[model samples]
Target: MPRVTFPHVAESYRSFKMLMEDLGNEVILPPRPSKHTLDLGVRYAPEFACFPVKILLGTYLETCPKGVELIVTSGGVGPCRAGHYAQLHKKILHSLGYPVDIVVFEPPRLYPLDFLHNIQRLNPRRMSYRAIYECIRRAWRKLQALDNVEKLTHKVRPRETIRGATTRTYRRVLEWIDRAYSLVEIEEAERSALEELQKVPQDPNRDVLRVGIVGEVYVLLEPASNLEIEEALGNLGVEVERSLFLTGWTRDNTWAETTEGLTVKEAAMPYLPELLGGHGRDSIGNTVLYAKRGFDGVIQLAPFTCIPEIVARTILPRVSEEHNIPVLTFFLDEQTGKAGMTTRLEAFVDLMRRKKAARRPA
Candidate 1:
């Protein structure tokens, strides 16, 4: 039984672990991204590689030494450099004498046979078809549950009368979700978690700023990568809504978009018709949607040098101007500091508040 691990990107790891374990594979969880992880990644990864690549590489470097024999990760398509990350990591690790086996899961549209084969390879016990289906169903449910909790926390955080209460409750609930084994247990954890969050005292009269977060999926989802931007905004009495979630991203990439209402592509079509790779198109589209939805402002977060986001950054100003919304873009890397981000967020919130107040009839 080869020890397997994947990058720790937000709470997606819980679902990934559940799937692997249900398939009878040994799972090795990596430590959350820290300064040491960044240092190791920077030491090995190319200087110009995007921030996520470095962080992911750093995570693998930290985990592989724990006798991990197989590394499982997803891949991308189009112009985003993420499509090549698995190969890049494999080469870098092999050169350093790790010699781990890396299995990259590209979109099924691009490599159907390869994707199925890779999944089969992971099942050491060769689980039956029904078992595998059940495993996938359970894992998907877990991912959706985690995402729901995240959305609830965002709403509660901004209105909470007790500072930091929402954040603490969120962390505790995540642990409960992670510990859940069956679908019934997962739902119980999710329901109990939501109830707990709603119990947090909140100010009904609080006039909070509503901000929409858009940018590269990695930066948008990963707390360490984005300096915990969501929590920071929530603490400052701002309600944050992200354009991307793990389940949403997985659906958009893996299957055809069957969402009934306004799709991200339709929203962005007026601004950017073509798919620019990664979440770039989604960022543009989501900003437009947010503007129409009357969000106070939009913040775009991306790893420095990410081509897709760089393209989105260029066009965001036009969207901001035409949509009558204020858009702020932050390019993050190893050099990004928490204090600087917080200061900017505070300023942005203040700006939004003034703008909202000025619109009210006397």
Candidate 2:
């Protein structure tokens, strides 16, 4: 069995490992993105490649030497450069003298046969159809459990009376979820995790700024890539709600397009009217939805030089003005500094607080 590895794309790696192992392959998990990873990526990746791509390159470089023979990654659609990352990574690795195979799971709508073939390629054991379905089912349950814990953290973090309590509990819950197997274990882990989060003492009457996170999925989901903006905001007494989660993103791209009875395309119709690739359309639409739902502000995070987000950023100001919602856009890259991001977030939170105060009854 070939040893397979996947790029770190958030907490999804835990679930991905379960899927690969169940399929009879040895899964080597990629290292979480860090300074060394970023530096490695920047050193070898193209000068203009986006942050996620660089981080992915860095991850592969770190894992390939560990006897990884195959790389499995998702493909993209529209104008996003992500669609080409798998091929690009393969060439770069081969040019550098590594002989690893990469199998990309392209959009099922565009390349149905290719998608199925790629799945089969990853199944070196040639597991039965029923077995493969069961593996995918269990993996999906785990992914959902992980996403729920993440969302709960956002709600609990800002209100927690004990500083860092939510973050600590969140990490513990993630470890428990990772160790879980089977649908029953996954559900039990999720239930117990949510209960643990609820136990964190919180100031229910405290006024907290409600902020919606919108942007490229990678930066939105990956803490290192976004410099842990959600935790920063929570520490500043802000409640964060993210527009993208791995489960929702996977469902939309693979099976269902509508979320909560509304498609991002429909929501963004008045502003964008078409997919600009990546999560550009979703960013614009979710921002609009946040404003309507009475969120205090919205922060959009994206990789520097990401074209889709650049387009979205240009249009975001208009959305802010028309919807009367504050929107802050951060473009991240290897050079992005945590200190600068923290300062900006603090200022944004202050602005939102003042805005909220002004709207109150005198």
Candidate 3:
């Protein structure tokens, strides 16, 4: 049995791990990213390659020695640099004398053709088509369940009467979900988790500042990659809202692409007014929408040298200036310092607070 491994980009890995287990393939996910992992990625990667490229590259590099016989990776088709990463990583890993076989799946990960092939390729035993399809359905449901629990965390974090209570509860709930044995068990975990989270007691009268986060999908969703910004913002007494989650993004690109006639380009109309891939238009639209919805500020986080977001970065200030909403753009590479990030975030929140105060009628 080949011991296969992949990086945990978010909660998506739990469901993926389950799916592979059901298919009879051995799956070994790399440990959560840390200083060591970041350093591993930066050392071998082309300095200008974006942050996610390093994270995944480093994740594979660090874990390759753990008896991994194969590596499962993903890519996208676009002008954006994302899809090119895995292809390059394969060459780099092979050059380093790691003999592990690397498999690349096109984006959405569960498209009919690629999804089936990925399963068959990784599995040592043959499975019925029904088994393959059913596994995907269950994995997707799990992704939705994870997102629901995460949304609750975002809502409860800022308003929780006790510091860190919501975060602690969220972590325990995640562990509970990971141990669940079935779909019903997962749902039960979610319900029980929500009940536990609600018990944390939020301050109803607390005038918390609200901020919206929008940016490159990986940086926005990967907690370690972003240095856990959501927790930082919540501790700063601000409510956090993110426009993308794993489930929503996969649904839109995989299933919803058939019906999404307007495209992200249309959503960002009159602002960016074009599609540059890597969610450029979506980022622009989210900033405008968040502004109209009374959010005090918007933060755009992305990897350094990310083309799509750099395109958005150029246009976001225009949206900020026009809509009168404060926007902060943070471009992160492995070199980003935590203290500096915290200081900038603190300053942004303070500025938004003063801005909000000025808007009130005397």
Candidate 4:
């Protein structure tokens, strides 16, 4: 049996980890990324690697000393560096003498059988098809539960009168959902979470500004690497909408079907007409969709040296000018400072407020 560990990019990852655990593997989750993790990644990662790759390297390094036998990670292949990330990570680990097995979950797009084969490695109970399907269903349920709670958090954070009230409630909600097993339990946890969140005193007329966050999945999902941008915006009294959700993304990729996101895809056609891979077009599409929905502003988060977002960044100003909405772009790296980022966020919120006021009838 393989003793496995993986990077914890977001709390939703807990859902995925639960999947691996239920599959009969001993899974070790690396600690949340911190200064120490960044330092380790920076020291070992090649110069000019994007912020995510370095932090991910740091994530694996932290797990190595714990005697993990396998480092399992999702894999991809395309026009972006992500296609090569797993191999690079494996090579780097071997170079450092870790010599651990790194299982990359190849998408069914490339080799139809690869996905099943990879999962079969964890099949201690005869690898029945029904068993594998059930494991995935449970994992999907957990992820969906987390996503629903997060959506509610986004809505409540801006209106909650008490500082950090929604954040505190959201943490508890996660634990509640994590403890749930069946679909009914998951639905119950979500309903209870929303009810609990509603108890927080909220100012219905607080002149809150709504902003949509769009960018690469790595930066979009990894709060630690992105400096907890969503929470920061919420605490600053801005309602934040994220462009990506793991449940939606998984269904789109695995099932080869577009969910409600297809409308966003169609909306983006006027600006970004091509599927540029690495979610470059989706970033463009999401911004356009939010702008049409009368959002106050949009924030584009990208990793330093990230090619896809770099492509998206060049076009955002055009979208902003056309839609009459402000756009702020942040390029995160090892040197990103909380103080500077906070200052920028404060200024952006102020601008949105003044602009909203100006638009009111005299």
TM per candidate comes to 0.95, 0.95, 0.92, 0.93
Give the residue spans of candidate 4 off by over 4 A.
249-262
Question: On lDDT, who's better, 1 or 2?
Answer: 1
The 10-residue segment of model 1 with minimum total lDDT is 250-259
Quote the lDDT for 257 in model 2: 32
**lDDT of model 1 at position 303:** 98
**Candidate number with the higher lDDT (1 or 3):** 1
Predict model 3's lDDT versus the native: 0.82
Give a tens-digit lDDT track for model 2, residues 242-284: 8888878532531243334555566689999888789899889
lDDT of 4 by residue, 1-362 (tens): 56788877688767777777877878778888999999999999987988888998999999987778888787755588887888898899989989888778877778879888877876655557887788788888888878878877888888988999998988887888888877788789878987998888899898788999998888898789899999899888899888788766532431233334456668678888876768777788778777777789999999998888899899889988987889999999999999999999999999999999999997
Candidate 3 versus truth, CA RMSD in Å, comes to 3.4
**Model 1, position 201: C-alpha lDDT score:** 96
- Residues 29-69, candidate 1, lDDT per residue (tens digit)? 97889999999999999999999999999999999998889
Off by over 4 Å in 2: 249-262
